[model samples]
Target: MRGGKALKHYVVDAYSTIEQNRLYYLRSHQENLWSELYYGLTDDFNRVDVTGDNVGHVVLPSSYTGSPRYMKQLYLDAMVVVHHHGSPDLFITFTCNS
Candidate 1:
């Protein structure tokens, strides 16, 4: 369970709103770190997207992949898996309700 609520639900809209707000709180708490993140980085941003990099920096968890604030979570996850598992040869996706 997350934030006292189950992840999957029929009420997607409510769940998404709650989750978004929760993440907003999390990210907002990190607002003070923005300047520190960009302090010595660079005036010339390297990312191709303007909208995403405007916020400076907010480290995202791996589970936030494909969401609005993806923020290199996929790259982070890939690096972790490669470091621990010695590179993957295959990937599989499946869904089930029990």
Candidate 2:
């Protein structure tokens, strides 16, 4: 491990930094080398839906654990689980009065 990062964590962190840079570059320009590959081999779905021509997008990070996208994924997954197993039998919340 270098700089306290394990080998696997290093790769993940490195990739995340690279991705953050890539997204920043894409959004910084009207068009870029990256954009040329938007629907080509170096591709995935758009991070955001564009409504106008020649628009830009900011790629969401690889994970958006508490963001809208995360919530949507959670909701969809919950619906699927409930559909197969029925709704959960109990729902509970723990609170601290302080």
Candidate 3:
């Protein structure tokens, strides 16, 4: 429903960002950044059943936690989710709890 549409939009936007920033976001040895973003979003979309009533939870792996660049990217991803789905009830793994 609405939530699914929202998630889809978010994924599309993430893909767009990766596509637009190919050189800047590339990893060491010239790896494409788009694959990671695409796989992550698609995997989560497939794993979770997002609905209007239930909240969609996106858990970033521990690897993405400390890096500033990754965090910035995550922030952008989150904005897309919020823009479409409204403020979620809770955000667990993304924040620093230290």
Candidate 4:
């Protein structure tokens, strides 16, 4: 939010087994610095699964959403974490059409 730029939008498409996908999201959002409300929401829905081609959109503050290097690092980190959680064959695609 400190960037003073407009929010950036992205579409994420993930293909994997339900359990694998669930684990991917769980690990991706496992950081402890999130607000209490966010923790509660994640805890409440920890068992949810995404079957087949799961697609969703997210709006991120500009300061945290740009730069290819940063995005690539995030993807790499996510893959590493998710790999440790379960399947090593998870596929994720991110698209920004804005």
Candidate 5:
């Protein structure tokens, strides 16, 4: 739960949008873990993909294996792009190797 709040804050700071922040939270944490769980619990949430729509939650596959440093860097890069694009929205696609 603490992890989820911390992650949510990071996402909110990165995206500066409530919807995007919630999306990131949905993707990163379990349904039971989040306080304001959106969409539903224990089922995949269908995300909106149109331009300017908030990118909803995502779940990475269990097979991803990347160093925490690398994952953080990747997330940071994505944040930069989102900040630049002003959307901070993305579909969660699990990379084969993180």
Candidate 6:
């Protein structure tokens, strides 16, 4: 990690069930380039449907064809590096709009 100030963007993804009401993927957004991983109770009602003592799995829709509503929260977090020497390995890069 560099000592100077750096630009950062954080994206988080959590999965929970209706019955357990557990929230997973509790972590810092800066450390990982990919979205955080979370696990929740299977019976979570707010996020999942629980039936027969089983909880449903919740996941972000990466792609959708029927409706755009499914992917309202799925996205990537990108940022630019301010001052740095040479180049450092990066997991995410900002796309310049021309």
Give the residue spans of candidate 3 off by over 4 A. 1-65, 89-98
All models: lDDT?
0.62, 0.60, 0.61, 0.50, 0.56, 0.33
Clashing pairs in 4: none
lDDT of 5 by residue, 1-98 (tens): 57788898887777667656664654667555554323343443334334544445344332233534358668988999888889846668666865
Model 3, CA-based lDDT: 0.61
lDDT of 2 at 43: 38
- Model 6 lDDT per residue over 3-84, tens place: 3333222111222142123223312222342343323322334555447654333442233222232343232111123233
lDDT for each residue of candidate 2 in 1-98, tens digit (9 for 90 to 100): 35565787888989899877865654575334334423322333454454685344454322434545567668988999999999789999999988
Write candidate 1's Cα lDDT for 13-85 as tens digits.
7878988996796688765534544332444455345685476566444356465435565677779989998
TM-score of 2: 0.37
Instruction: Work out the TM-score per prediction.
Output: 0.35, 0.37, 0.25, 0.24, 0.25, 0.16
Rank by TM-score (best first): 2, 1, 3, 5, 4, 6
Show model 5 residue runs off by greater than 4 Å.
1-65, 88-98
Which candidate comes out best when scored by TM-score? 2
Across 1-98, the per-residue lDDT of candidate 4 in tens digits comes to 65333333211222335546654554466454245533344554455665553334222221243544358668888999888897767678999999
Error of 4 at 88 (Å): 9.4
* Error at 80, model 3, angstroms: 0.7
Best by lDDT: 1
User: In terms of TM-score, how similar is model 5 to the real structure?
Assistant: 0.25
Provide the clash count, candidate 4. 0
Question: Cα miss at 63, model 5 (Å)?
Answer: 19
Model 6 misplaced stretches (Cα beyond 4 Å): 1-34, 37-54, 67-98
